[model samples]
Target chain A: MKILVPVKQAALVEDDFELRDDGRDVDPDFVDLQLNEWDDYSLETALQLKESHDGIEVVAVTVGDDDAEDALRTCLAKGADRAIRVWDDELGDADPVVIARVLAAVAQRETPDLVLAGTQSSDLGFSATGVAMATFMGWPHAAVVVALDYSPGAATATVERELEGGLRQRLEIDCPAVLTIQLGINTPRYASLRGIKQARSLPVEELTPEDLGLEAQDVGEQACGARVRKMYLPEKGQAEMIEGTPAQQAERIAAIVKEVMGG
Target chain B: MGADRALESGKAVMGGETVEPQTLIGRLLARPDAYAAAGLLAAHPDFADHRLLRMALPDRATGLVFAGMRFSPACLLEELGGWQDSAVQRRLAGNPATPAPVIARLLDNSSADPDVGPRLAAHVRTPTDALPGLVADGRLATRVAAAGHPGAGHGLLLELAGRGEMPVLRVLSARADLSTALLARIWERGDRHVQAELLRAATCPRQLLAAAAHAPHALWRRRAAGHPALPEPVRWRLLRDSDARVRAAVAEAPTTPVELLHRFQADPAQRVRIALARRQDLPPSWLDSLARQPGAWLQRWVARNPCCPRQMLERLAQSAAAEVRRAVSRNPATSAFMLARLAADADPWVRAGAAGRADLYPSVLARLADDTEVDVLGAVAANPSTPAERLAGLAMHDDRDVRRAVAQNPAASAAVLAPLATDPYPLNRFVVSQRDALSLATLEALAGDPEPRIRFIAWKRLGALAASH
Candidate 1:
């Protein structure tokens, strides 16, 4: 069995970041790129499944820039059998739908038994990618899966999905399905020194739209299903801090309460 | 059809300008301690005239039922039984006035929503006979709720402890009635996670602690080391445990002898030494030496320690590391002169930290209020020591955060806050509503403000004030 996991490197913006002079977006210099927190769980889930099953393989895939290779290397070091990065200038500004289309094209080529993705990325947070990809592939999908048990012989996977208000729904899905992993399903293991050294020597496969037999126009901004018209920081609220000496403040509060309550 | 016709006829009898009788009656029935009115409304002869029965009761009626209002409890129960909303059923289960038979029916209805079962089991009035079934329910949350239920019997708690799920075990451990035998069963059957939790419980038996002291899991060993009841020999053994985390936990434990704590002050691991540095009970003489250490991190911790000599904070205020300086800036023990000096530091974060201290002189705050950094200005606006005049100036600052901080400053007088009460941002108005010191006039104005949330807060404050009086 082979499992395909989609990983992403999301930007961690500082709390105090300010918009650029034009006020369109935050200044890029203040942003630190790191692994998307949710994708870390997805990758860990795939690795755990591989560890339990005999003759099973895990492939880590991403659609990102050169810097994103760091996340792919981390995946390889953690036990993924292979890494693939899909990059193209046209895909730079791609929306979740466009990214899902590109990943679907790769899935067609890889033809893995299952696809795993994070429930949502920390940055952008478009939770539509995995479900849309599953729809594109005509496969059953479940999101926010907290528990999973699969039997290769039976070709069936039992999963527990987290619902709002602490409710859970148990589902049994057929193979060749997509499952978006939720956090806290398992504690992700760190990459050992030996794994890190081995990862450096592994060649990461790079692909583009052309390699997938697609033109630039096939996955461009025009192909995007949605667009972000504007972005701005939310307004900040103030917390009223009571002042005066402890005794004075207490007395004043008492008087105010009396006035309001009409003693 | 008859009810609709009656409602139309009642509407015709009342002028359109006036509130419909049904709406007024529903509101009255929703009031707290309105049991008599509720009973009267329920028993009204005319179907249309009986507003409570004529109109579909709003969701707020659920809260009134749960508020111990005994007016027509049977009628409310009947009305709730006809509704399919699980939320209403959950409320019914919580209402102490709810009759025992209704609760029993809710329990027996297998098709009832999953959430209702746990609430029923946890209800204070639930019979002991019904608890065991709910405790064994397949849903983990229901089982957890049952285990934590105050009325859970010993047998039910023992069953949950035997289940060995971490959540269930943790809740069972909190019960004062949990027998030693049950604790032992949980300790033996539980996985490493459960064992760690058990070690942390104040009620952990001595036998469990001794056994856990030798557990292979370092987390369990580390937690055991911190147990206040651990034998002295076990504590000493854990101090030298192979894991640094265990040694750190032991070093931080107040039960550790002062002599041992002093020896850990120089441990190779910074975490151990840092833990020692944070102990307020550490001899002041030793604190001097720890302060002299070359590590800036150690100096930062010493600067923040409550027992650190004032002289030490003054000295660390000039350190080259912005972090050390920042730590001193926030330390209450730091002298006013040192805080003023740090407020002008090249690093904006250090200055911002200094700007937030209440002890800073008004002159220093005025200077900080003019700093080029918006965060420093924001800090000044938030400081209680900031003069009302300075707050008035900042309330109109271009930076919305600075203005917000000014609006929130408790020191701002009514004159300073009046303009902000109508500030363009609703959040600013919302902040004004939270001030307990606001004049009654201001709160009354905010109570009628356009924003629903602001109005709600102002009204809540008004209600609290009226009740207090």
Candidate 2:
């Protein structure tokens, strides 16, 4: 069985940051790029499944520029069998659907038994990539998957999908499905020292849009469903400082809570 | 010249018409010949289009150009971090704009350069994740820098505390950000200097201070005695600590209850009395009584305390010991009359003390400013009341400390400080670099100083200015 994991090198912005000159995104100087937190879980889920099944191959892919190879390297260090990074200058800041198009192309070429992707990247939480890729591939898909029980080459797989308010729904998904892995699905292990040393010698495959038979219009801005017009931080909530004796302060807090709750 | 040839090729590519300088430079940099491209890039140091520069990365020669350009965007810096060339990686390791994650990645790939490990360890932006790898590097300097890193979290600090290496522990002990629980864990490691440093840290917890107060080691108790967080019961116990030094430290601590002050005056140790005498808030009656005591050593401390009575200062001013007269000159309570008398004393050191007083008469400062001795001149130079003209002259003084004093003078302006940035002594420039308000020109000069540490400081200040704007 082969599992495909699509990961993102998410940008972690500093506490104090500035916007780019265009005002559409943050200036990269104040941003630290790391493997996305959600991707860590999805990749770990793939690695764990690989450990349990014989002849299992876990391949990681990312749609990013040159610097994104570090994310792929981290995935490789954590036991992914192969890593591929696809990039094109035209794909600058591709939206979720465009990204899914590229991932689906790669998935079509790889023909893996399962495709796992983060439910949403931390930097841009569109939460649509995995399901969009499933649509492109014409396969069954699930989102916010908290648990999965599957045997290699099984026609049907039992899965637990997390819903709002701490609810979970059980479902049977057909084989060769795509699942967006959620947090708490499993604990991801850090790359061991030996694993890091070995990863240095492992080669990460690089491809372009053309290599995946993708054209400009297919995965470029034209295909994006959304475009960020401007980005700005929302006004921070102000904390009210209550003064007076403890009893008076508690009374004020109770009054405020009652007013807020319409009691 | 390589640039000439590249320019010729660039014009040829541009259809033989004159193009904008930036556009021309971009075309020259994109030439097929790596050496020519590098040469043109080297010639135009101000070329800052990061995208164009990144496009030129296929040429290894361009790595050298990329290495030194301060304006390289963060993405370019991050990409350069993984360059096959260690020299490029080393430069990125020190670049201020290099993101924390890039530093962490370079630290993971640290085997490329022996110097990169320490550079990344010292980098201000290096994230917390890089610290363990730096510590695992096993170099004392690297570990020391890692311990001092602001990003080092409690877990890494705990691991460092377990190591018990003195240098590492010393750096860790100075970190004020550690949690009280973590600090107690570090204190439990039981290195004496670390314990003393922890006691000195303002954030040192109440329990740790109390524990140190009961420690068998008197040094720990003494350091603990002065801690602001020491419990009242612990302070009382420390007042009677068998070690006179511990009792003396308690005597000097501002937190010591007023009732404890009366007990130290009667204490057997003269050091305890002297410590009590040194308190600025010492009662006038107590200062007079301490001054009446026999030893010149005890009397000198009383004379130096601002609370010393005028009569006591007057009498102490005439003491046989030049030290007591000098001490009296340092007292704010000493009348200007006494300062003038001390300023004219035969002892240049006595005059030096009077010269440093902020309240010294301008006439007296002008007189003392002409004193042939460097010490008197240094003190005069450091006095805030000294004329700016005198400071500018003193900045060119033959003695390094005198010049250093001028650099430190509160009244010293940009005109006076500009010359000192090029002073023969690195420390004079170091002092000038530390001024809270410095001109852009002065910072730029110091940013190129021969001393690497001074240059680093200037660049950091410059980076801060850029960030704020």
Off by over 4 Å in 2: A1-263, B1-104, B111-124, B129-149, B154-215, B388-469
Clashing pairs in 2: none
Best model number under TM-score: 1
Per-residue lDDT for A166-228 in model 2, tens only? 899999999899999999999887674356567878999889989999888897788888998
**TM-scores for the candidates:** 0.52, 0.45
Residue B147 lDDT in candidate 2: 80
Please give the CA lDDT of all the candidate structures: 0.74, 0.79
lDDT of 1 by residue, B21-49 (tens): 34434444464223323333333332123
Clashing pairs in 1: A261-B466
DockQ each: 0.01, 0.01
Worst 10 residues of 1 chain B by lDDT: B1-10
lDDT of 2: 0.79
